[model samples]
Target: MFSTSIRFSADCVDDHVWLGDLEAAENTFMLDKLNITHILTILDYKPVYNKDDKRIRLYIEAEDIGSYDLLSSFETCYHFIENAVQNNHNILIHCQAGISRSATIVAMYFMKKYTLTHEEAIEKLSNKRCYHMVCPNNGFQSQLQLYHQMNYAVDKTHELYKDFQSERLRTNYGLEKSDKITKTEKEIIDDTDRFPIKSEEKTLETEEVEYQCKTCQHKLFTRNDLFYHQQGRGKSDWSTKPLELDETICDKQVFTYYTDWMIDVFDSNVGDIHCISCQTKLGEYSLDGKKCECGHWVMPAFHFDQNQIERHNEMNHNHVEKS
Candidate 1:
């Protein structure tokens, strides 16, 4: 139990930065002795402190499980830690076990300050402790790697972030099988994310262009709903070997980012998609995702046969918008 002191002799991983379990936080004696003026807690539940305490406290509710997205808290945590360090104030970061969640944040701070990849940050942190103390699970490890690609800031609009969120939601759905999940979990899973849909009747501004069923001209999707990918190059259009796509471009599939209609087919691993208006078999979708022939991978890939659907553009959105 945290009631017993588990505070290490030296939990400081960087200048004015310390890492440990809850003991480093709840033990008032340690806080006073170490001159800790700021506290950051990342766990499944919030911890309590004295009301009259002068120190600053930031609480982020995140489980330590592999699927939970600690990535979302990167920016907020970094800001809090940086502010304390700038003021020359000592701060302690802690989680339930201090193995995954707390360690991940400390690594993130080093990643920003030193411009290091997550692995390098972990190595630096380990050297500071004189042992191997940093170990985030596979899921968090993947998120940290992505954080490196994102340059240590959360870019919700980036293709990789979008893909990460989609996969996270899908994974949550699989793990959380009960009908009555928490409201937070429900909102997180049901959200349309970047599209910002209030209802299914109205479309989004981002997706002005549309794809229609060729046989009956039934309305399908806007360009915004589509998932654009890096085209592959092959000496010939149908060559088996993977390479960059050339001028002789032949795209055989159309992919969607997300749609309300897909909820039914995606209950399992794979499902077929038929046109809503004419009931014509347009294509198929897979929750497991598939790689395009052009050598790009799409997680939870929703693919429509190019021959079965016709493109209609309102804005001719050839270039993707980045915010």
Candidate 2:
């Protein structure tokens, strides 16, 4: 059975851009409801969709794995989205979960078109798409940083350009370098030169915050049961460790079910957690009290997944309302 947690609603990021998961993108009824005129699919393999003459479709074959070169498709996908939006056509971009691959593309689009930094673009997208989570993987994050440096750096002369020059030098000197400098290596060089290398240490900084169900505004987890936690030490950290749900948190607040993907991946009977009242997916919970790599035996709470719930902040709520 498909878990309700796997089901997601399309979120409008702007007047012309909508972000959603594969399920929402494939849902004909949802697409019609959103009046999406164009669809952009990013995946490792070819996407199979019902042929719809009325809706334009663009498929980008790229793996969601960190090693995949997503940068190659950035320019093409950006222009495709730009052209569609320029013509007043609403576009929906999707990947498997709309959390990584598709989110990275949309964030890059925002950076290129709006001249926003990586952080700014992510925040903007998150605020607009109040439901869906927008967490790009580490590889994508580094690439985006490089993209920002190349496109938005105040100093025209940066190490990225210097690295390109060095690569040319190595090639000219007949030095044995790889036939092609992979995108991942380039990003590493860019990062090493531009910023301090990050450490592997995981630190949990918790903030007591009230969270409410995104669908019905029902109070679910409060400061006692909910706390925002980041894994890494730096501002450029991409680790979005789930919110820690106290074991004492009311079990009645959520219902549990499992998806095939979860069962296959976790290799155990794991259930997707969702709000009991609105049936909105909160996150995945471990019935066996599994311990994460961080050595914390906290339940896996995906309250950070914007689709499930949001931190109860009056200012943020007002800002969302006004926007």
Query: In candidate 2, residue 292 scores what lDDT?
Result: 35
* Candidate 1 Cα outliers beyond 4 Å, as residue runs: 1-10, 174-323
lDDT of each: 0.71, 0.59
Give all candidate RMSDs, comma-separated: 17.6, 24.8
User: Which residue pairs of candidate 1 clash?
Assistant: 232-244, 232-245, 233-243, 233-244, 233-245
At residue 164, candidate 2 shows an lDDT of 36
TM of each candidate vs. truth: 0.55, 0.47
Clashes of each: 5, 3
**Candidate 1 at residue 97, lDDT?**
67
TM-score of 1: 0.55
Which regions in candidate 2 have their CA more than 4 angstroms from the true location? 1-8, 152-323
- Write the residue-wise lDDT of candidate 2 on 1-323 in tens digits: 12234344678897789898888776776667667889999977766555544788899887776645566577779988999989998899999899999999999999998998888988998898776688898877766777787884322245573443333323333223233335653444333321111223211212223456778887664433322222222222223553444422221232212221122222122455566567677666553443333333333322134456655543333322311
